[model samples]
Target: MSAHPTRTDTLVIGGGVIGTSIACHLAEAGVGTVLLERGTIGSGSSAATAGVVRTYFPGSPLTGSLAVRSLAAYHSFADRTGTPLGLERVGFLVLFTEERQVEDFRREHAAQRAARVKVELVTAAEAARLNPLLDERSVLAAAWSPEAYACDPAAIVRGYAAAAQEAGAVLLTDTPVTGIDPDGRVRTPTGDILAESVVCAAGPWSTAVAALGDVHLPVSADPIELLLTDPPDTPPATLPMTLHADSGLRIRAWRDRVLVGMGRPGPDESRQAWLGRLSRLLGTVYPALDGIRVHRGWSGALEASPDGGALIGRHPSRPFFYAAGFSGQGLCQAPAAGEIVRDLLAGKQPWTDPAGLSADRFPAVAPSLR
Candidate 1:
């Protein structure tokens, strides 16, 4: 007799950190699961990320609390999964050159304090102590979020994949879910999968899969690039990830290299131009690295939601659910986001209030946050 075809209770598309984290959480909750990926695990944004896990988001629902919990959950993932996860504890240093923005930072800091974020406002004098390389020419105060941190995004995904596999979850890399049927069924590149529920975690490409449900995932893709240098023997001991206010510069130190990114500049410029802009920004912000050469470079695309947050909840029309459009901040929010989805699917308590992140939050015929 022929064996019955493989079937799972749930199907998760996109095997990046988000997808794998969701799959692993569901499996741990005793949900039968199968995760499909278009490429090898961690090949997407998850791998290309510099992994800046900071807790300074302004919004209420997902910005601050989700980050704190997610940071803690990463530790749990590493401990439970037996993987060498890079859970670094470097804090964040955000500087403002404009006086008006410094006031805005104070309000943000106040909100963070209300939200119980371990962050504080510091004077330009204190900021200089942390890194003399800071652009003192543009004098202003800075905010320091001591609880903020970063991790090796690639290692986190790998840990989740390994744990999910150990928990009896089937992981299929290099296979894509081309379609989703109305009856909770998934059509893959090679075969059909009948699942009770499907979780769409396809980062930048989520819309392509969610469209089958008459759901318009308004998220586009744009590549963010970065360059690194040789490791500094005495790395900025705690060279916190610094994000410049007006300049849109994001910087961090790892191993021996300073990994920096120029926040998603408009998509009009050429890739090489983007690289040049970042190089100049880094050089300008830290003159010490002026002649310091770039040893390597990488680019990763991200999806954004209209509200600048992630969509994490059940589909309004479909009984079974999905989540997408993390909007560039998904790396740090993946754990709590996945847990909320997993809980909702399992009918658990403490629901994820996704009103702000509703798909309807977009403008009329909304544009994706690429």
Candidate 2:
């Protein structure tokens, strides 16, 4: 440890949704916490998020369970912390264009129901009834979950930060951690911070951040683009967030306008070109938005694990823990991820089993920079 080290019970790296949420939970648990962010809070991948909160994952019990727990937390966030979650439960719709897809959803639906999740499997006509903009002719079936909601990504980050601060957690923005060791020493620009334990919740940068401590995290970064289009002729405030599973496109109401998300498999050659192509797909999904001009578009990095699920748990042999690799569902699982981190540090069993999220699931390999 450096001279005059800033000591803390727990030192959290990153200020995005996951880190802030963990800080809030740790501080609320009476832990002496310090959170460091290389830049402003929610300025990384979180700022570019569409903020869609849905509890729908196929063949992913860990992610689904976490989303369910996190959704419950979001539902009571404002009341618990006095910071509004800005949640809008307009519902979520997952569309299937073929019978096979419907069958897949049916299996997943049964699994969700077994886990006590509330969901409805609807036909194309019923789906159209929920969102009149839907092109009933193109849809075969859909899964609707009325408990799904959306919120301001930045607001959630700020709310968690506020709650953390209120509970005596120290937040340091623009303070980048230069290095870290397995011994729980964080080297930053200002000075070293000695902590009993450290957490890496740096969103897409988790792998790189963990490397500073000679710990390899199997995480990859994927660039995602989001386009906000001009308000429709008649805004539908009650419109459910719609997902075209076949085309890998999603759309949700954003105030008077609409927010669109595109999941491109590989690197994007051009954002404008990509957005243009995705816009066309949106038109196919909902002919009502044909030729609708896009108002703005932006791109951000999303982290992923080999299994396409979040990595949350303690490192192999270090006084360190991590919560990352959330792919694109970080917002929906942040609350539960925070609770898991807190429970791990406290040596208490979490209410929900996190077996699938253990870091040991993947090999200890360094993340490659593409």
Candidate 3:
């Protein structure tokens, strides 16, 4: 017997949050869509995300705008589809340690306010009061954004995928796309899929996916280390997800335990070594978590764009399109990106100009996916 035909108006080549979100939007709009995942949806870096949702990019106006617009979609997600986004409104706090950093914090607060985010500058004491675990002596000032939240990244992916499936989109988990042609022909193990358009949202493997279409995406793999502590007696619900700007460390509530992440300077160290360093850092900052037993830890890959903004638009040279290069903010921007891709496919004017995010901005320096 012949294999069943697998064709779609648009073939999305990843099942992460961004790809799934795009599938949901396109299928909901009555466009035939198919999503293929090498593994289960959200099984990659999306599963390892911190899921800190906040519209507080200080110097990045475009990124900040996209985040704000996406937040609206997340806020209404559950109401529209009856699937919870797993959002925890624990708030977000950015603690500044240096006196000079105070001005920068103020600037970010002003920009956030301009973006209509409910935010303010709080004194160190007030910051400590907000989260008792905060080290007042180590903090000079903080930007308190009450509207920020923490969420389950996997939940968001499942929600998006479920919605997409409900809208008639075909989701083939564990189905990997081996190759693609510029003519929108996708090669897979079971069969070939001829599509009118193909979207590359393969996350860390996005560069490789682009190469399949003879396109180059200026995306780099960014590995991040995160440590999760054993469940404590009382869940630290009062503690807002805190970013220690000076030390490049962030701590947040996760389940009945806490999740700690160390950013920058040592991305190549072993997990054990990173955890040791994290323990020392915690001792110096939030003494409350000093002796917390680190039950588990792992490193995950995130993609970075040259400009720290997501690459979202049509391919300049082929019948392909893309939505990658999120630079560790994919979850935060997935909702709006879905809409952006749908608008591009439908020939409608996007709410935001995607000219700045086009992949053609950089030279076509294609690299080996091997």
Candidate 4:
């Protein structure tokens, strides 16, 4: 670790997709940016993400707009970053099993239409044709978005890192920030950095990191669980990501294997108990996969805000900014978030209205370093 102090116009914390994306945007805009990560880039929550990119955030028009913008960026990621993202546009299908669920989706469908998103309400038979593994008989209705995609999250992070470097942004991995001053000095094991502005994009660790600067961010870490299974017999060329609205079962195909995601496990639940619950849910949702063996299962954490949306803006009384608490939507919303943060730092108006994502929207509390 060098004792020499560094200086930059903007310092970004975290190296996941969000942080990398912000760095790339800032550097591309000719800002002197430096990014520090506590671990290898994308090794945090970004690596564990399902990487499903879709513009289907029900009831949140602001999030939906961000997703729409991000989808456009992802479509051109290879051209912009000079790196392939391994993106597969297999689309997204969400299933509803009850009348109430159908009504809820109907409202969402109307909102999506108003947003000019390419989405449609489909019958069970139509959904079955889109995803053969779906048991249409059990579904009352479904929403299909043809523009959805699944990509390699790590690839996206790497691509952004490369792009940021190409544009003159310094990215340091394994450099954990130990302390932060409201006056723009950050202390790390490697050395200290003085910046005009600091951005806390440290996904699940954002709350703790902000506390280091005596700021309180209303974010909490939530658990995420996922399972990978062998491809079923007679697999389709591509499998559209499927979600069961009632049960919270999400399944998507990733290359040769299928990925299954379930709701967060209970606080007291053991790994075995959680796996058992996931198995039963899988069997009930897709009867054909009842006996399929899970190849692997893992758990991760995501920063969740009370409103289940992102917190993106500068702290009211601090000389720093934050883009966190996506509530599991960070991967898909990274591009837009990056742009928003860049615009804020530059004193320029963002393309999209960011009032809904203000960090000051939540009440301020005493910084809890604990």
Give all candidate RMSDs, comma-separated: 3.5, 3.2, 3.1, 2.5
Please report how far candidate 3 places residue 293 from its true position, in Å. 2.9
The runs of at least 3 residues in candidate 2 whose Cα sits more than 4 Å from the true structure, single-residue gaps closed, are: 1-5, 265-273, 363-370
State the displacement of the C-alpha of residue 186, model 1, in Å, after optimal TM-score superposition. Answer: 0.9
Model 4, position 208, has a per-residue lDDT of 92
Q: Which one is best on TM-score?
A: 4
lDDT (Cα, tens digit) per residue for candidate 3, span 31-120: 999998998888987887877888766456677778888888899989766788777788888888887778876666655666666667
Ranking by lDDT: 4, 2, 3, 1
lDDT of 1 by residue, 1-370 (tens): 1122257898888899889989989888888889889889989877777677866764343467777778778767657888766666777887877788777766566667765577777888777676666766655888787776676777778888888878878898878777777887787667888888888889888887788655677677766767676664456666887878777677787666788777655658776676677778777778777666675567788777666777776665565466777777888788888788887787675344655555656666334321
What TM-score against the true fold does each predicted structure earn? 0.89, 0.93, 0.90, 0.93
Using lDDT, give the best candidate's number. Answer: 4
Summarize candidate 4's per-residue lDDT along 61-121 as a digit string, tens digits. Answer: 6788888899889989999998887777888898888888778777777667766577778
For residue 283, model 4's alpha carbon misses the true position, in angstroms, by: 1.8
Query: Model 3 Cα RMSD, Å?
Result: 3.1
- Give the Cα error of residue 245 in candidate 1, in Å: 1.7
TM-score ranking from best to worst?
Answer: 4, 2, 3, 1
